[model samples]
Target: MVLKRIFTAIGVAAAAFALSLSAASPAAAVPVDAPTPVKSRIEAAAAPDTAAEPRTCRARFAENVNHRLRAEAGSAILGSIPAGTWVQASCTRVAGGEYSACGLSSDFWMEVYWKGNWGHGAWGCVQDWEYTS
Candidate 1:
């Protein structure tokens, strides 16, 4: 109990000090954008993808939140997935980014494609959500 109290006191003091420092900091101290190195690294990792090639991704749920693979994408969406979902792990566009699907019927589905590689996810709640039966 004493140790817990001591820790709580330390946390309160640290928070007070942090608040004071933030109040004293100049507006320009924070960078307007991400650090240059982070941007470069992201670009490098994404370099393998290109418009000329195909960007397709696919996936299958060993089991949804209900612990059942038989539960199709529609049920999966209704489960833990958020609305307006667009995860690239589940499905991909047919030709470019024109058409999309998260397996409204098919047990296995593919959502999006970037370059020659395929991505995967739960990508539910697109415009076709009504047809999910």
Candidate 2:
């Protein structure tokens, strides 16, 4: 009778342990992989894609005259390109020398390729208006 009581008690304790494990919240479970914080996940989603390549841009001289390409925007002239000549350039624009040609109001310049070298040149209303999307 005592052995029977001892086995019954052991069985009850084992069942209680099993019940405790089954009743445990998922939050209490050990993670198979290390967990990342919520803030880290949110920041990763919000971060700008640094892997994206910059847009390839191009420019052409507006008139029959040659336009000066400068070492820097609005700086010393490095080279020249004749009108209607198209050259590869950076899409990024900056405020530089004021130009009124082709009714251009934006004093914008962009890095351009001329004579196998990169230089800065006007990318104003003329270039914008001449090229159609």
Candidate 3:
């Protein structure tokens, strides 16, 4: 009977010691309403000269040409410009070398925009020589 009582006393003492240690830690004293620290990030501003000017020129497609998302021929074709369609062309020469497509050769790629049901009047690239200004 004495041995059982001694074992029960030791177990109670161990539990009390563990509880006391947890309460003494700094993390346990933090208030429940305390605000957490916040982190912020900054982004670089855009330069005025880097922005492209809104340039528009009228041109007619000599033949059907694939309107690409990028200046390169192998890029994704956003749409196709039909022959005889007058497009508002804003062209810029892509440096490297000339490219031939739609029975024309030129080093420039024109950003063609047309009015249709497509959102915001879709824009795409076509070889400069493919259309006559």
Candidate 4:
């Protein structure tokens, strides 16, 4: 009788474990080799225009802000914007995305024309958070 009771308890435990595993499994599982449909859809829907109308603003760079070739934080750094140098910035939304930098609340990129000793007639991108208008 004791052996039979042990066997029944073991069976119940096994069934409970199986039920827990099935409940933990995702309802719909995508194959590992398959492309992610949602990510592609989001990217397609968030594509930004390069020719969007830019807003003009005069901004002063923060103490540690540098100019970048692209709006992304990992882009190539062109040069540093000197503190107290008021730059005429043409602000535009980033293509397909937004960026935050220098602890400011804006997510736009400001294109500033580089002049003086830095580089002549070159444009650089600064995150909106890195500057104050």
For each candidate, give its TM-score against the true structure. 0.20, 0.44, 0.40, 0.37
Per-residue lDDT tens digits for candidate 4, residues 4-118, read 9999999999999999877744645644676423221111232136535543455555444666677655667778777657766544334322445444333345566555422
Lowest summed lDDT window (length 10), candidate 4 = 119-128
Of 1 and 2, the candidate ahead on TM-score is: 2
lDDT of each candidate versus the true structure: 0.34, 0.55, 0.49, 0.48
Q: Which pairs of residues clash in candidate 2, taking residues 3 or more apart in a chain or in different chains?
A: none
Model 3 vs truth, CA RMSD? 17.2
lDDT: which is higher, 3 or 4?
A: 3
Error of 3 at 97 (Å): 6.5
Pairs clashing within candidate 3: none
lDDT agreement of model 4 with the native: 0.48
Number of the top-ranking candidate, with lDDT as the measure = 2
Provide the lDDT at 25 for model 2: 84
Per residue, candidate 1 scores C-alpha lDDT tens digits across 1-133 of 9999999999999999999877845766776876423211111223133445544432233223221122233232322323333333432322112112333322322343223333333322233311111
lDDT, ranked from best to worst: 2, 3, 4, 1
